[model samples]
Target: MHPASAWLANESAHIEDEADEHDLHAFQAIRRMDEILVNNFMVFQDVVEEGCYDLVVGDEAWDVDYFLHENPELKRFAFAWMTDFVGWVPMPDGGEHEVALTADYNAEMIEQRARYGRVRDRSIFVGSPEDVVDLPFGPGLPGIREWTEANFDFAGYVTGFVPPTQQEREQVRRRLGYGEDDLLCVVTVGGSGVGGPLLHRVLDAVPAARRLVPGLRFLVVTGPRIDPAGLPRRRGVSYRGYLPELYRQLAACDLAVVQGGLTTCMELAAADRPFLYVPLRHHFEQNVHVRHRLERYGAGRCVDYEEACDPDALAVAMAKELHREEHAIPVETDGAQRAGEMLAELI
Candidate 1:
């Protein structure tokens, strides 16, 4: 069980990621997603309505109704997009059932297939172009405009996440002690109520990893809920406390190691960097989505956490990937810009 499970009753929470030492899962991702919606929507409810924002995007349910209710014109323009899966929905009225997506996983289009058979569903939710962007990573958000051009009038936007500013990057960079030559290996060490076992596995093999790259350097960032002391110390590895200098670091790094978190993955894709993803154990859905990109799409490799325990095994995997002659993953350079355009068009 996740530590935050105890705090589930409370409207607010700050749970620690104790999965590795204690029996807890890191529910921080969901919590953060919820927090973002509640806080952002609450603060800008009036602005959103007055400005006539076209769409509001989010990953969880919090102030979704407030956003919808506040804007009368937006009732038709607004959409609730789920970036994860389209399989199910948990209604506020106590019901559950299979649901269909509005778009294909990678298609830049939206089409409704069906409704929740028995659930008393409210609020329009879709994982298709009409609602959510199908790409697992956020870099695909820009494509929503293309879909909007054909489907609906996409106006200004509301999203659960935001891009970092240049000033934020410099501050994070200084704190992480990043040098020009050092390769910043940004990672989301704990996720969705789980400590990243793959991270620990990779850190344990850092010495061997260094041997593989000879001069590889890294800046591994873990969530604040995780203790810095718990992470293994190494000559080339530096642990950072939050997702600082995230964009700059991602852009600076030659490669990345991460969980299949959509937020982190999208940022990396936006940075146009190759990545090595290790989906959390038991997260079958996440594993499938990440594997689809890493293996099927040839973006990167999805190595099992267990295999990372052995230095030689990890070294070999690293060697194989680092040595690959294929070009790095191609990320759209104008995702944010395109997203902005979509927002402009919608408004």
Candidate 2:
């Protein structure tokens, strides 16, 4: 099950009963632990002794938050790698920590000592073959390009990300209440953390889009952590606050409008959905990730905050990327499959 579904199944009862925020969070954490326990998610065991995994892929927060709460066992054979565009997640001791399977050599030994219990016995910390060096490197490696071109529809770039299968396309349409003719759906994701600025700009860009596509529908999925107040509330725009069908929603749309966060971007790519991205100004990592993806595979168009706010520019960009008789540049093969393959190799 997806994380959101797991959350609801694990915590709905406690969440309904609790009145305090602290209590709710505690119950939620407990629910997470329960899921891990019941699933017998011995990540390390599966990776090491059983050799059941090959690779683990995600941004630092996803790696840290996920394993810390559940699947710690997998860390044994997991390659805790990272791209440079990651900001450390804050730990309870008042400092931020990189979400790696293994501690960095340069980090304070005390911090490493604290991680003694957390680090798996056998693991490697790598920067990957395609690590970005500087803005001049443009995109990373040819593999990323090969992946995109092979899987995506380049001529239909304007049509949005290509759905992997007809079934997924239908599910998305059903979920979004779209008929075959309702071709214009713009999706926005990542409601909290650094995506806030990017989301705000998208809302600001909506007016510009409405001018171009008068009947366009906006589907926004503010993350579970964010409040609806953070985004502009508009009519004709459907807001499914923290819904589970994120990939489905993106697939249903003609184009997605979102921040350059890795997980969200990866999901968009997996859905083969074309998108228009806005990199948040203060979030350097997000900006870098967006620029890298754009240069590497033409997966989507990048619209910085300032650019997204410009009515003429935003409209032009969106039109070129979303409505043209073209499709997105392909992405690496079904990333989830690739990820699973990599995990298998690791074991």
Query: Could you tell me how far off, in angstroms, the CA of residue 85 lies in candidate 1 after the best superposition?
Result: 4.8
**Per-residue lDDT for 10-72 in model 1, tens only?**
332333322342122223233244554566554545455456655655435435543443333
Over all chains combined, what TM-score does candidate 1 have?
A: 0.56
The candidate maximizing TM-score is: 1
Per-residue lDDT of candidate 2, residues 1-347 (tens digit):
33333323333333334323111222123434555444333332333455454544433323343444344443643443323332222122322232231123213322332455344322221222232323221122223333333322221112123445877787768766787766555555464443455556666767777778767777766677656675778766766667765666676677787766655666566566667776544343455544664555546777766777676787667767776555445654443343334445556
The candidate scoring highest on lDDT is 2
RMSD of each: 9.8, 10.7
Tell me the number of clashing residue pairs for each predicted model. 11, 28
Q: TM-score for all predictions?
A: 0.56, 0.56
Off by over 4 Å in 2: 1-163, 191-193, 229-231, 334-347
User: Which residue window of length 10 is worst by lDDT in model 1?
Assistant: 113-122
